[model samples]
Target: MKKLSVSILYAILSVAPIAGAQGDIAAQVVPQVLSRSPEEIRPWRAPVFADQSAALGYNESAFSIPKGMEKQVQFWIDVYTKYTTEQGVIHDAENVETVYEIVDLKGLKTEREKQKKVDEVKKIIAARLSTPEEGERLRFQLGQKDRMQDAIFYSGRYLEDMEKIFRDSKVPVELTRLAFVESSFNIMARSKVGASGIWQIMPYTARPYKMISPVVDKRNHPLEATKLAAKLLRQNYSMLESWPLAVTGYNHGPTGVLKMTKSYETRELGELIQNVRSRKSFGFASRNFYASFLAALEVEKNANKYYGSVVWSKPLPAQDLKLPVSVKYKEIVSWFDGDDSKAQVYNPHLTHKARKGHPIPAQTVISVPKDKYNVALISLARKDRTVAMEDKKGR
Candidate 1:
């Protein structure tokens, strides 16, 4: 099959969400879900990997937390999963990019009241135990702009392709949402810790996946990166033999999460995260990654409540084209309409030099307008000699 690269990140923005009283929106899930501690929350189980495979035990009934740990799991899921909306905070599970600020800056009014509300918000975040400093920085907020809406709109653009890749790899298609938790579908997202792209892939994961590094991180290419991620996720699932652990392993790494499970000899993922919360390696992001996925999944399943209503972006009509050889921009423009910037837009992964007369790696595949395939193919077939040898080296 000839895979041609095509840009598919286009989106159609809808009208701003309906205006409503901040209290009205915040009242939906904030107080009940946020204020409740692990002890107060009930243990509940949800199906996993049900979209495709079940042999891994995900096909079985919902799996709830072990006794005495429901609240702990629920706490992380709610806070970590919740994003700020214009009305109130909501879970990514709701499928809407809504955020709610606290109407009351709980600890700002008076010293006593401030500390009391600060403690309450702290408890919701569990930062009281983990990073109490966040609570101090966190004021009670009621309404805020839903910044994630644009990202969510873009998510509709690539999610289908991602799921197709997952299906082909025999990994659970539902893992597509992991991108939402990772980088909110931001194609160019980068982390201070060095993770990048839609999957927020770190340097270590990037190397094994064969992505171009530093200057040309293929991790930014959603479709290619997702394929690599699915394979990694599938391998993790095989090693850990637990869906939750495998999902968390994407963030914490399979070796450590597997070690965590072995240390306690319990396959219960919630138990593992809860137990290892204070470990040097098992920091907040790692501890909460899997549960946060669950939280997002839950809200997504119930998009009406969280998002109110969502508009999806149509998938881009595109085809992939592989470079026959590493050629410079002048050569590519001969094939494109003599517009270098237009050619660059079609292939975002190309380094600046590649667009400015440097050789585009022969192994590189670029997405082009669907109609441009034949033209690109003919142009490449008729031109340069094969850089097949260099392609393997680059890969």
Candidate 2:
């Protein structure tokens, strides 16, 4: 198989490890500090930081970092906050805390050159493991740092709306931060396996929610995608009854997670990850899904501390108008006084066919600028009536 890019490695999908990265490498142990009390380790406990009230825009107590997984979570936190996209960490796959080196790929002219460098590091690590002096075996992993600053900046457009959707759906509003892990809040992000949008939902997963269709693929629309994601997460939680498992279920299917729970005879996420046999189905991505989420949550909540004084984009202001009749994309733009750019911005969900003069189906909720909503609605009504009269005359 071809080498996976660093960006592809971090997406919420189970991809193969980089080429020539052998298993059974040695782990370089790293020390960790345990600050929280045993009682406070529970997932439902209140925020550890007292000053940032409503820090995540929800009940901050619902999701805590699992005890044994703190190092893993911290590793991801560094990936998001400390490192940039130009750098990647070469580490033990199973033992994530045992990072061997941080490779700087900034000067590499091409992806092939970068992969060559990564493969060389992997071979050296594998050779060390082969030596009797190392005396331990491990699998190698390449961890890519996210473009978190950009993610956080883009998140400003939909964060409040996402929180509201999750809140109204009765799902944990903090789960909205999953976008940071999945696609770094990049609206146009599309995974190799066909997961799309800020939520990174697969087509199969989105079909039931009616999020993918001929006229529009709501998976690319931040707010619409959030509504579906909230519902899917709520269902997963309802089934698994554990936020860790439910969130993991977002990346690995809930059914697969349910099987792992049964196989391991435990609902404790840390235990399952530690004990379950790694395979093609439930590998690194599934194991680290929740840890990455916790990492994202912590990093995003304390964004200012990590990234000094971020100026977030304002929430887009628009009104949703349910169409009374099928209308072409240009017609909608006409209603917006021919500001095609603004019309496109407000309707990111429109598919290529819809944009190519095809009529958007009736009853579709079209977003229009809040200020222009009244006039747009009037214009649409007038156009619909005129079309009806023309059809009657033809008949």
Candidate 3:
């Protein structure tokens, strides 16, 4: 039997990992597909999970963790994250482009040419992987070790909220796994293009999901953003009808995905990825979005397999407080020991004024720490009394 190199396999699919927060090429054979006739060797049908757990199982059995598809996912995450962290706001992150270039460069038949190309690539990169150790660290960052351990930690802390939100939106709970692809559940993760929060929602997309900002961007609020993610994803699924396409649309816009799905007359995600990437409007980011998700899902599903044991983050304990009217930031913070940043953290959906300790619009829903529940309520009541007193005196 003839063996196919990992790079060759990735080339056919254009399977670079998702852009920032999502990631590229590494190896693990898809035996069933690999053994097939030349015509049969493309990404198999995208799995439609019965539930969140089953979808995760597909990620594991189908794509092994460390050496599996997740390794590629980790690759992109490390590459892109490294760029953004080091360069500080990479407007056009070149991680995806670099992967494509690497594939093409490797195709150069001569070792001397490839060496020359490697030097060229190295001089351009901020994170120097010149040493084997540096390359290993990049891979190891998300590869089934300490970094994935962090993923497992955040997963424990936030998965319940994600599942509940998805359930409420009437979408498949498994969709929660996309966070592993988007931001690695790092709530603070921000892409250069302003894809914010754990789900990496762009500002424009958030508006359609009833998320607005300059006050509060719910994207940074884990619980609220997860809910919005479910709604946005549900809308995508409703439009696309295919789970795979729906998931792909989450990374790329649904309208474009819908157009390709119709024009191509097939819903095979693998084919669509290959075809769409060739278009002038599209690129590797969208092409490999699903694969990136698959990689994260695979690693997340088989956490114990890669690491000896996982320590999960504790579930968030908080209460939703709906302000009866527009409330001053002072009033909100008064309830929580006058810490302004706490308001920002809990009420991430606030506008700039409210987020920065100014008055927020009435009827805003904010998350408050459960431990401070009574104090918050009392503070609000006190504000109401003070307002009434002032009105009485004026009368």
lDDT of each: 0.54, 0.67, 0.54
Candidate 3 structure, TM-score to reference: 0.64
Best candidate per TM-score, number? 2
List where candidate 3 sits over 4 angstroms from the true fold: 1-17, 20-146, 276-279, 338-343, 392-395
Candidate 1 on 165-250: residue-level lDDT in tens? 88778776667877766765656555546666678777777797668743356876788789889888888988988777788788
* Residue 17 displacement (Å), model 1: 22
Model with the higher lDDT, candidate 1 or 2: 2
Q: For residues 1-395, what per-residue lDDT tens digits would candidate 3 score against the true structure? A: 22221111111121112432312222110101111123213221222345544332133233322222343355544433333211111111223222322313325554455445444444444254455533322210112233444555656656776777776666666568888667656555555566777788888888876576556677777887887787777778779766677777887899988988778886767555445343445455675577666656655565555455555644545688887666877777665566555555455455556645666766678777788787777877776788889989999
Give lDDT for model 1. Answer: 0.54
Each model's TM-score? 0.64, 0.78, 0.64
Model 1, C-alpha of 49: deviation from truth (Å): 7.3
